[model samples]
Each structure stands twice: as structure tokens, then as C-alpha cells.
Target: MSRAWMSGRLFGAGVIGAAVVGAGLIVPGSALAATTCAAPPGAPAELTRVQDAEACGSTTDGTGGAWSLGAGGVGFADAVDGATVAAAGFDGGAGAGESRAGRLLAVGYGADSLALGMLDEPGIAVIVTGPASQAFVGDADDPVLCEGNLAAAFNLTAGSGCVLAGAFRYVTPSPL
Candidate 1:
């Protein structure tokens, strides 16, 4: 794939290109095929930790058709294990003729993890956004620490169609 196409795929814009390459639906050495992200040269190996949790809440908009928010979860990998964690929740309404009239729920790992320079690594930063009222199940093999570029994302839209849940895992370099 070309450098321009690769850049678009990394930022989540090249879905079709990625699908063609990922599913092996395209021929090898094709120019339009999707390309994966590569790590920067001379990047330092670091230790990482994965953290995950879930919560429940509700939202109000004074409309007759009230929307309920519950079962929220968040997961993310951190270079620094055992660091204090914080979470936030949000909700909004459609203006009038918006086709995408729905609610948005998001969770973010504070700047401490990103500030440590871990976020710069390939697949180190993770964000999952989807429909509201989703529940995520925890993985049985959860790791508290990992060595390498830990890639983690959560599907918050599961269970009861309105519950929110999250899971996080970290990757770091293994000790020699």
C-alpha cells in the first residue's frame, strides 16, 4: 500500500483497504492493499500493565422517551502499574434532523500513562466507541503486566443492549 493510504488506515479511515489486506482478499504486493502500522526506529522497550473495570449509571433529557444508561466499563494499558485511575461518563441528545441521533459514552486513561511516552508506540493507544447501553465481559486470562506494545480495545456495547463494560491489557519488552 502507498504511504498516503497507510496513514489513512492507521487513523481508522481506510476500513475497506484494511479489510482487503487483513482478509487476504487482495493479491500480494498489490498497491491498493492495506498496510499495518510499524514501530518507530530505536524505540525503547518498556514494561506495561492492563487495567479494566465496569460501572452502572443513568441519563435524563426531559423527553418523554427517556434513555437509560447503565453497566459502564473501561479498559486500558498503562506503562506504570498501580497508578491512580480516574473515569468519566457523558450523554447528549440530537438537535432535530440529525440521522445519527444517539448517545455517546467514553472513558479515557489519564495523561500520566500517555505522558510516559508509551502512547507513541504502535498499537499502544486504544479507543473503542460504539452504541450506548453495552456490557463487556472480562477476559479470564487477564494480565496485570506485559512486556511490548500492548494493543487493547473494548466493546462496550454488549448485554441488555445498554450496559457498558471495558477491558484493558498491556504489552512490554520481556526481560532477557
Candidate 2:
């Protein structure tokens, strides 16, 4: 099966979440809830696309949490082809070691079907910026006979603040 993995890095303030679409298939809101975060009005949103399988396998370096993959939900795979196939943490807070005051959401996707294999699996990781971080994961209306995984991470900073992050992985049939 041919697998394609994509990672997105977003920096902001409020809630954080993710969504996945493959081969014209869409997972509804009921299935995958979006991550929410309070992004500054003029803060530049930096999105860097990581290509090359070798680069994806490299360690994700940052100031906050380290990178590691675990089993969650239905179709969660940690080490693929001897490489850690997963997304890294999102830096939201102001400075180094300075955590956010809200939730950080992450999402991952996986699949077994070849037609839908392009979507493959996604890895989600989150860091809380405030007092607490809450997470929710479910399937949308039109459900398919595929495996899915949903993982969440939250960091609670002092002073009535919350931070949240999550990820999703799903498996679908491939085109013959």
C-alpha cells in the first residue's frame, strides 16, 4: 500500500484542532471535531510543508514537548517503515518555556484501503496554554467501513487558563 503523510504547524492563542480529506472523501464534523485556538489578530501564521520521507522521519525539534507515537482510537500506527510517522507540537505561547493560556488540538489519519490509502494516517499532539485542556473526537454523518484513531493532549497552565491538542488517523480501501 502507498502511504502519504502530511503535517501542519500552526501558532496562535485560542483552541486548536485538525481535519483530513482524501480521494474526495470528507469526514464530517461529528466524526472529527476541529481544534480551536485564539490566534493574535496580526500574528503571522507560519505553515511549513515537510516533504521527502527522510525528512518526515527526522526528529521534530522545538522548545516544548518531545515527539513520540502511541496507540489511540482504531487505526493508530507509531513506527512506519522504521520511521516515527507522526506530527510534532505546536508552539503557541509568547516566548521560550512560556506556555499558552488555552487549549491545543491535534489530528491524525490512517487507512487500510488502497483507494483511500493516500490519506493514510495522521498524528495529533497538543499542549495546553492555560489552566486546563479539554478534547472531543467522533465520526461525521457518512461513515465508512474503515479504521480510525483519535488522540488528545492537554496542558493546564496556572491562573484559570487551559491548553488543548489532538490528532486523528484513519484507514480506507484503495482503488484497484
Candidate 3:
């Protein structure tokens, strides 16, 4: 559908753009008409995990919000079983505005499934910046985060290591 590709490194770990596209997580430049809210005035007008899920009637936890990604922004989205599930965007340049850390909640699907996906980028660790007890299982579907590779997720948590959010499967050992 006329996808515009990007090629670069993220967090100095793995390559961006191509990995997510190859994984078929998102169709770049696809219409986000499903989202009820207007795109933020950031560099790249796109939706995030919370926004798409909520707008498309996937979840209603009301965790959707926007963060300033200054310039050279990149966005990613995920769908499971033909339903739009999650999305996120990152600013490639110096970001603007306050940090939205701890604001976005790591939502899970029915029971065993989560609304997250792997970007197919090796060495790019998905760091969960929520409570200390917060943890996740990667694409390998490993029961623990240590055993599997840390898959990339959407993160609006500014000043954090990666812009992509973390947690494919929530594995909290304690209360948040």
C-alpha cells in the first residue's frame, strides 16, 4: 500500500523500520481513520498502542495520551487476528515536552495473550519503565524475560532508554 521505508539504528542496538515492516506488524502510511482522536502535532502524525486499541474498540482502559516527538518521528503498530491492537511512535531527534513515564499501562488480552508484538530487531531490548515489579516475556513466548529476547514495544516514557513501549507478556512478580 505504498509503504515508505526507513533504515537506521535504534538505541545503538538494532536496525529500525525494516524489521517492523518485514514482521508485518504495520502497513506504513495506512489510514488511521479508526482512531477518533486527531494525531498529535508531532513530526510524524501517527497513532500509539493505547490510542488505536481504544479507538478501534479493542480496549477501554482510557490510557491513551500524546507525547511530543519533536522531529524525525517513527511510528509502529500491531494487529492480532486482523484487529488493530497496539501502536507507538518515537522521535528521532531531540524530543520536546515533559516525560509521560508510568502513564501508559501495559494491557493484556484475554488471558494468555498480550497486545504487544516483536519488531524483529535483534539486540534491541524492550525496557519496561513502569513499576519495579513490571516485567515481560519476549516474542520467543518464553515464560520469563531473562530466558527470551526482549522484544520491542511502544513507550511514551520520555528520558528512558528506548522510545518503543515494552512488554509482550506482562510478568509481574509483585503488585504495582
Candidate 4:
């Protein structure tokens, strides 16, 4: 696997990308060599707390079918354990086209167990436009997005999809 790695923003993984599509969250473009996967460096400063448990978001599929769903979570991970994928539309089954804000769900190492956290954010646009098997995560099992670069860097990793996703440290309380 020959993955392209720039520098600086190689960290964590989100919920959407290449093969898996991050639960079901569609990007709105095709896949290719994404050169914009690196997002600045640090997480946002103005972080917000998730008021409710429901995820609010809108999605437009390839067929142009726009849909919305609340309380979108199927197999969401527990923040108490570790960082989890908080993505919308990623949650498959039932509602079909919706999921919890896997992008906004992140648990710190300890203490603030249920509070939202900020990790090194990756470029969703990159994963969205990069590969079908790539997505982003906040900091799951020691970073998945950046892990791709490492694996691909050493030609030791291969997946049908990759992710450049991560929960925003600066959440807006609810999904859009």
C-alpha cells in the first residue's frame, strides 16, 4: 500500500471515507490522491459540550436524495472505554441513512469521561476526496488516520478504504 503522507496533520481518524464511507456519511466527490489531508496542527480552541445524546445532521446521497435523522446511533462506542467514532450517516441499519455524530463524540483519557474532547483533526475533505477505504478518527486505538500514513509510508498497510475524519474539538452543541 502506497499512501501519501505530507506532515503535521497526520493524526486520528474520523468516520467517513473510501470503502466504508464512515457509517454512511457521504462526502460529495470522487476519490483520488488527496493533498489536503493535513489540517493545521492543534484542535480548535472554542470547544462546546454535547447537550443532548441525539445527533442532528443532513445528508445527500449520490442520487441526490437528501435525508435527516435524529438519535442516529447504532453501534456507537462508549466514551468511557476510549475514543469512539461519532459520525452521522455512518450508523447503518434501521434508519439506514443516519448515525450519531461520530465526528463529535470523543472521550478524554480520564476524568472528563463523558465530556467531548478535541484530538488532532485530519482533513475530512482529504478523506472524502482521497480513497474509498479511508476515513478519520479522533484518536482510536492510537490514531487511525495517521496510522494509514505510517502503514502506507512503510508499504505495510492496505485497506479497501481509509478515513481522514475526527471529532471536532470545537463542537456546536448539536449536529447541522
Candidate 5:
């Protein structure tokens, strides 16, 4: 699987498999859902919406756990492991530090997952807001992000409905 990622075979775990089908990106018919970015607990009320959408760049790295498009900080981590650390805190402390506000945005599934299996289950999660370069994961073809799919969870639309990409840090963890 790691080789596949290096060869550009997979993306955003599995939710994203975009290709230049013509001049447009190939978005899976059943994969995308509009999600809502509500104010997470402990977050100041002024931040009603904290983030926006962005495109993923070249696949510089690959772990392979595959993050649900809707998953948020520490939201999907509980699904894989019973524990989590905030990812938003790269201010100084990094790497498993509890101070950072982060979540499990992606995981290894192929060779990378196989490698991770030898020891601990490795997962990567980004924060709720940031520049596109740091906020997205995937090649430029399709950037997998947690915010783009928030409409459903918040019911931002009339009746689009929410799809469980993973868990919402602002809320509790729920399966998709």
C-alpha cells in the first residue's frame, strides 16, 4: 500500500480517488457531504466557523489509516484508539503533546499500515483551521479535509443530512 501511495494510487484514505476525468476533478457521487463547523467546546463563542475548504497538494507522505472526510480533531482518533491528543497545538510542543488541538485526520492502510502494525497504530490529524498547504492531505488532485463536509453535521443546508465521516471534536464521537 505504501508503494501505491508513492505511485499515486490512493488518497485521503479512501474517500478521495479523484482523477482528471476531463477538465474537472472526479468527486465520488456518494463520498462528499456538506458539513457544518460549529463552535467546539472550550472554544470562544466568537468563532462560529473556524475553517474553510482547500485543495490537497502532492502526496509528500502516506500513512494509510484513511481518514473519514468528515472527521475532526480527536474525533476519529477514538475510533482507532481509545485516546487522543489535540492537534491544533503546534505552537511549540509537538508530537503526542496534550496541549495541541489536533485530531486523527488520516491513517495507514497499505504498506504503511503494515509497518505501523509492527508497533503502535499511527494516525495523523490536522487542526480545524489553517492555510490550505497545512490543512489538507492528498495530492493536488483531491485534498481531503474535515471542514468541507461540515454542512451535514450542522444541518447547514435545508435537508442535506449529515454523514459520519468520523467524530467531531466539538461534539462526541460517532461512527459513519
Candidate 6:
């Protein structure tokens, strides 16, 4: 279970989704039905160790809403209600207080839902639109984001679907 393995899992899921789509199987909008904004259901207990976790759910009409569970350090703003959930840190720590607009994008019915977890420099981000979703992890500056659905584990250092190398942020220590 390595970061590379996690990335591979994400990619594989995406391929499966694509294949299904190509076969004329329409993923119903209901598939993205709303749920309480929280860590994905059946998530591992280790997720509690994450310093922060953010989650959002998409409504039946395609509108999205978000909430958080943890230190309350991370905040979310909907760039496009029901389509995009933007995240920011309260105190402007590493990867905080910045717009990820250019780096993140979701179109059609998939823009309104997302989930994220941060522990120090390592983290994971997920965006859900109906049955289609995407997951990302690693360096906040240059993360490896992919489209698909899968259970993510934040506690494992390099487990499958875990954060990758260079995903950790290296903050400079302040002088005493």
C-alpha cells in the first residue's frame, strides 16, 4: 500500500467509470444524491488522527453543501454552489489561504461535492458529482488528482490510496 498504489487505484476506478459510460450506461443524477457532509461512510477509525477533515454533499437538484469535523481549522467556500467546494485554512498555515481555482475544476453535474483531510503537510482531497468522483493527495503545491471513487485512508504513511511522496509540506520554522 504505497502512494503510487493509491494513485493507481484511483486511476483504475476512473477507467472503470469511463468504460461504463462508453457502454451507454448513464450514471443517474440520483447517484450523486445528497448525504450528510462528513467523512465518507465506513471510513477507517484512523481518520480521526487527521488534524482536519472537510466534506460536502450534493443535493438532488445538483446544489452542493459542505461541513467539517475536527479542529475547525479548514473552511470551505462554494465557488459554484453544488459544483465546487473551495477550501482555505483559518490561520493561513501551509497550503492555506489560497485559491485553488485554476488547479481544480469540475463541470456539468459533478462540481458541487468534495472531501478533504489534512494532517500536517500530508493530505487528501475528493470531489464528488453524482456517481462520478475524483480523489487527490500529496504536495499541496502539486498534488496528484484523479477522477474516480474509492475509500481513502489518511492514517497510513504510504498505504494504498494514501498520500504520495512530496505531498508533505515543509514549513520553515520561525526564529525564537
The candidate that achieves the highest lDDT relative to the unseen native structure: 6
Write candidate 6's Cα lDDT for 14-54 as tens digits. Answer: 63354335322322332233212332222211111233242
lDDT of 1 by residue, 79-110 (tens): 11111111121121100000011212123221
Q: In candidate 1, what residue range of length 10 has the lowest lDDT sum?
A: 92-101
lDDT of each: 0.21, 0.21, 0.26, 0.22, 0.21, 0.28
Top-TM-score structure, candidate number: 3
The local lDDT score (0 to 100) that residue 79 gets in candidate 6 is 22
Better of 2 and 3 by lDDT: 3
Q: Write the per-residue lDDT of candidate 3 for residues 42-63, one digit (tens) a residue.
A: 2333433334223221221223
lDDT of 5 by residue, 1-176 (tens): 48855443233322222111210221223223322222233322211122233111111012222122221211121122231322211111111111121223222111111000011233332222211111222221222333322211111111111222235423223324
Give the lowest summed-lDDT range of ten residues in model 4.
148-157
Model 2: residues >4 Å from true position, as ranges?
1-43, 53-101, 107-176
Candidate no. 3 TM-score: 0.25
User: Residues 98-136, candidate 4, lDDT per residue (tens digit)?
Assistant: 112222321111111111122332212112221222223
The alpha-carbon lDDT assigned to residue 159 of candidate 3 equals 14
Report the lDDT of model 3 for residue 69.
15
Sliding window of 10 residues with minimal summed lDDT for model 5? 110-119
Show where candidate 4 strays beyond 4 Å: 1-54, 57-86, 89-118, 121-136, 139-142, 145-176
Model 6 lDDT on a 0 to 1 scale: 0.28
**Residue-level error in angstroms, candidate 2, position 120:** 28
